[model samples]
Target: MNLRQTINSVQAHEKELALFNIDADERIDEELRSFFRTQNVRITTAQTASGCPEEIAVLAAGETVLAVVEVETLRELVDGAGAQSRRLGVTDTAYSEVLSHLKETTFTSCETADMLYASREIEDRARRNGTGTVHAGFQRCSTIVSQQAIYEDLSRTGVSVHAYGVPDVTPPELAGGQVHAVGGEIADLWFVVYDGGSEESQKSALLAEEDSAGRFYGFWTYDSAIVDSVCQYLTETYLGGNGQFPQFRA
Candidate 1:
């Protein structure tokens, strides 16, 4: 669904007593109002960022409230509000934990796409290499592959693979037949290949390329029998389809 619809869903899920506290500044409040209006939601209060102790207390009590804190206001609250403003200890402990959890659960459009791509790349490389290990240069990159795989494999009874983090300057040849690294890196690079055809004739492939630290790049492809074979391969390989990978820890 679209972003407005998504926000509406969140608002609908919220409890009736949940308050949406926004900044009192005209410009900031107007911006937030526009956002909530698009989702057919309303703000309960518009007060100075530092003037929402009651709202903060409610949120700290585990109420599902939405608060709009300006960047400057967030900084002020975290960095000591001085003698004139009362400090809301809720900001650091309760609010911070909730925000962190929300941040972890939420994914941006680009981030979701990147994660899907990374999962496919890792799975395809593992299959092409005929090995269980998928090499990544960075931990974030590896985590993306592992996390996706953990979910995908659990849903399907498929062979799982492991991820390895290698140095950027590591030789691609050492990574077996399929090297999976970020594009343009010295190691093997993975890319998505789309088949431009009708639904019945469409296909997708994961292409991998290996390059010396600076020279002699070579490429290969892992072709699938069907359009969704690539996605299925990823889901089964990492996350486990049909709950098969129950204990497969990332």
Candidate 2:
């Protein structure tokens, strides 16, 4: 079916979705065909469907596309009865004359091909690494403490310390198979990221902060004694290193 016809037929399905891509030029706004025509208005406008604002007047603009999306949700009417499904429209609005504009509505052109390639590269690497305990450095805390001591005694003397999570399960691309530090912070997987409310769920807060790495960056605080204890233990352990070959017993 033609795209326009398909767009008209979209309705949320309980177990599936209907999607269609429309060229940017086919949109309500001036499309590719009117690129040259758009220049006369650019002096007073900041919108660019082609992502090529004033560059040669989109001399060779690529085809931009937006996805028409629809979603379905189900709710249980009773304890054992089958749930009822509700159809949701993507472009629908409470006012019959209005339309919705979501980030999903943004047009993506050939510019995204590089991003797509990078994602595929990351996927290919995970497949090669397989599922196994990747001991990045096999540092048994004792080793890290020693390194910390050496760094302190020679490089830094009185600065408070922050520990780095080593052997990060999945480090950034530039890490080169060697993860020296853990990420900024770890989430409490056992606890709800937030206290749930009538308007929102705890998971909603977490999901809202979820980043490209699939991690939720939650804020937290800690007791000073707990911090001191950790510092003292590491300092003592490192300072009391056994008199062994190639060791710093200072």
Top candidate when judged by lDDT against the true structure: 1
The TM-score measured for candidate 2 stands at 0.15
TM-score of each: 0.25, 0.15
**Residue by residue across 149-248, what tens digits does model 2's lDDT show?**
3223221222122222333243222222222342221221111111111212111110012345644222111222322332233333432333111222
Cα lDDT of model 1 by residue, 112-202, tens digit:
3333453454355434433222323222244434445442442233323223223334423221122223222212333333331232222
Q: Number of backbone collisions per candidate, in order?
A: 20, 2
- Identify the runs in model 2 with alpha carbons over 4 angstroms from their true place: 1-221, 241-250
Q: After TM-score superposition, what is the CA distance of residue 21 in candidate 1 from its true location, in Å?
A: 5.6
